[model samples]
Target: MIGEFAKRQGVKKVYGIVSDYQVGRDMWASLKADMESKGIAIAGIDFTPIGTKDYAILLDKAMKSGADGLALIVVGGDTVTSLKQGGDVGLASKMKVMGTMLMDETQGQSVGAGGALGVHSTLRYHFTQDTPRNKRFVAAYRAKYGELPSQYAGEAYDGMSWWLDVVESTGVWDKEKWVDAFRNSVRNDSVEGAKRMRACDNQAEQVGLFGTAVAGGAGQPPVTMKVTETFTAQDLFKPCQ
Candidate 1:
């Protein structure tokens, strides 16, 4: 999705940080191809060994690479490391920084309220989404879990319910058949209300609310986004080739 977004924005030179995982390496290779096909330049590529404690050197390399944007694929401790390193080196203000699911609401806090401001990332759902099905899902989730559901939890519930719907519709539990059904289904209704969910990728296709980390409110935690605009998934994701 980040690659697609960069392509759409006509980004010419892209840089990214990845860990020593196979997925990270594969993603970088794939995006490199995609960008090349689109005539974009990959200005820099940096790989940090997994579980590395210090990122100052890697972050400095990324900053000096003259990239128009940066994508961070490292998660957990590394996500925080990348963010802090970017801020300390003044790269956060110099480049457009985006991240994967690992950089969700929880990790955003660890980067500090001010340090994480204006950083962009994607998610399947947010509690503040205004759809009706989402409202019900939120209410029921809170009723059951005593709080809001994270993106992962919401997607898990939705995936199960979606599978059930497919099973009942087809009267078969064959894995291939169910997969086909899910691929063909169009979810215009969310557990909260009428928010759109894309069946093709099993991802919510509704507009994403752009949020910025702010100081935690009186009973709230340290990191929260002040949603700026709602962007559609169609705008972010391209059809599979």
Candidate 2:
């Protein structure tokens, strides 16, 4: 979806910057292949160490390489640092910034107000998303915890809720039987909406949201993501689905 977004924005060249790790390498490889397949040129793929504090040289290299965008493939703290540095040096003006699994609400807050504008990322959930189901969940969660639930917290809550319900329905103490029940009985109605566990793999097949981070004012989270597209897990799974 990030690649698709770049194409939509007329970006023709991408420079991949990622953490020097297995996860980062794999993701960068996937992005590079996808972009190239779509006829978008990959100027280069560069790996930065986990604790990189200075992205000036890296950004300069990407700019000099003539990349129209920077494809970030790192998450958490490393992602935050690189994004802030990218913003600091006005990298966004030169090239689009985007990545996968990097720009969630917490990371957006870390990016601070107006810092992550035009930064695109893929996500499964966002607090600002407006839906009857999501609204109810957010209200209940904020009431209980005095704050909005992060995506991880929401996932954990949904998992427990589904498990308890499935177990109650099964009315069984047998471990094997319960596993089977869980595997088969996971057409769960979650805050994000209806989702079903793939019976073959027992992985919850949920919808994915692709979005771009936008600036939010004071008293709100540092940034908010505007959903640009949605895709089904089944559509992605293909043969498995």
Candidate 3:
């Protein structure tokens, strides 16, 4: 989706940050291949070694690389650190920024006020989405966890629950049968607002919310986004042909 968005926007070059970890390296390679196949060029690639505490220098290199956009794929503590430093260096204003599913409200707060505002990325769900399944999921999650669930938690919960449901219903771990059943399942009953899960990619497709970072209420922390619109999976994703 990121590649398609960049391509559609006439961006000739894309920049990305990857961690030195195995998974991060692998994902970066995949994204590079995808972008190249679409005729987009990778302007620059920066790999920050794992456990690197200071990102000021790294951000400097990335910003000076002359790329038009930035995609941050690192997660958890590393993501927070990068956002803080990225904001400090005015990277967001200088370049279009997008993040992975891990860029949540908590991380947005660290980016400071208006840091990630208007930054667009794909997601499985958002707290502001309205749906019966979502309502039930939210209610149940708060009831169980004593707090509101983020998209990550909701997606994880839904994926695991769906898998469990299939396993229990079929009473066997037949991988092929489970795979087929999952592909054909129209799981409108998701707590994460997913309409269905694609067994082929093992990814759930659903309406995604786009949001901008905004100041939280008085005396509250910064928020990641103010809901802009509900985008269908098909709308956000362009089929590769």
Candidate 4:
């Protein structure tokens, strides 16, 4: 999603800042592959140790890289710190910034709408998803928990719901039977939209959502996510190897 969006935005070059770890290394590699496949130059890449608060040097390096896009591939508290400091240095303003999991409801609230505005990322589930099912899910979640659901919470609910449905409908109590049922299930009514289990790899194939942080409208929360584009499962998922 980040690579495609960057290409559309006419970004010919990009710089990346990622965590110095296995997951972050994999993410950086994926981003690099995607961008290079689209003919975008990788001006520079930096891997910062997790929990590194000061981004003066890294941010300065990115600024001087002559890149039109920045890929941020950090998570957890690192996400908050990098984004806050990135804002201070006007990085987002200077380049098109893309994140792996940036500015969701929790992070957006922490960064505030001002800091998160215009930042884009690919999301599987977001509270701002506008649909009757998602609206009900969000409302029920907020009513019960006093807060919106994140992607983690949403996936848990969906997975649990599928399990129960399979058990009830098939009257299967065997663990293997349950697993098989799940492997064959197709959930068209998920809060995040339609998804189906790819039995070959047991991977869930679902729609991909590209979202951006935008200030809330009237009666909305201080920070809200706006889905700018939606990718079909076919457009997103790779074939099972």
Compose the digit string of candidate 2's lDDT tens values, residues 54-110. 878888899899888888888668888888888887777778888887676678778
Worst 10 residues of 3 by lDDT: 219-228
Residue 199, candidate 4: alpha-carbon lDDT? 93
RMSD of each: 3.8, 2.5, 3.9, 1.9
lDDT of 3 by residue, 34-92 (tens): 87888878878888876668888777766787877776777667877777777676777
Q: Weakest 10 consecutive residues, lDDT, candidate 2?
A: 232-241
For TM-score, candidate 2 versus 4, the one ahead is 4
lDDT of each: 0.68, 0.77, 0.68, 0.82
TM-score of 3: 0.75
Cα-based TM-score, every candidate: 0.76, 0.86, 0.75, 0.91
Model 1: per-residue Cα lDDT at residue 120: 65
lDDT (C-alpha) at residue 91 in model 2: 72
* Residue-by-residue lDDT tens digits, candidate 4, 37-127: 9999999999999989898788889989998888988878888888888888777788888887777666788986556877888776777
Summing lDDT over every window of 10 consecutive residues in candidate 1, give the lowest-scoring window: 191-200
Clashes of each: 8, 0, 1, 0
The segments of candidate 2 whose C-alpha lies over 4 angstroms from its true place after superposition are 7-10, 217-219
Ranking by lDDT: 4, 2, 3, 1
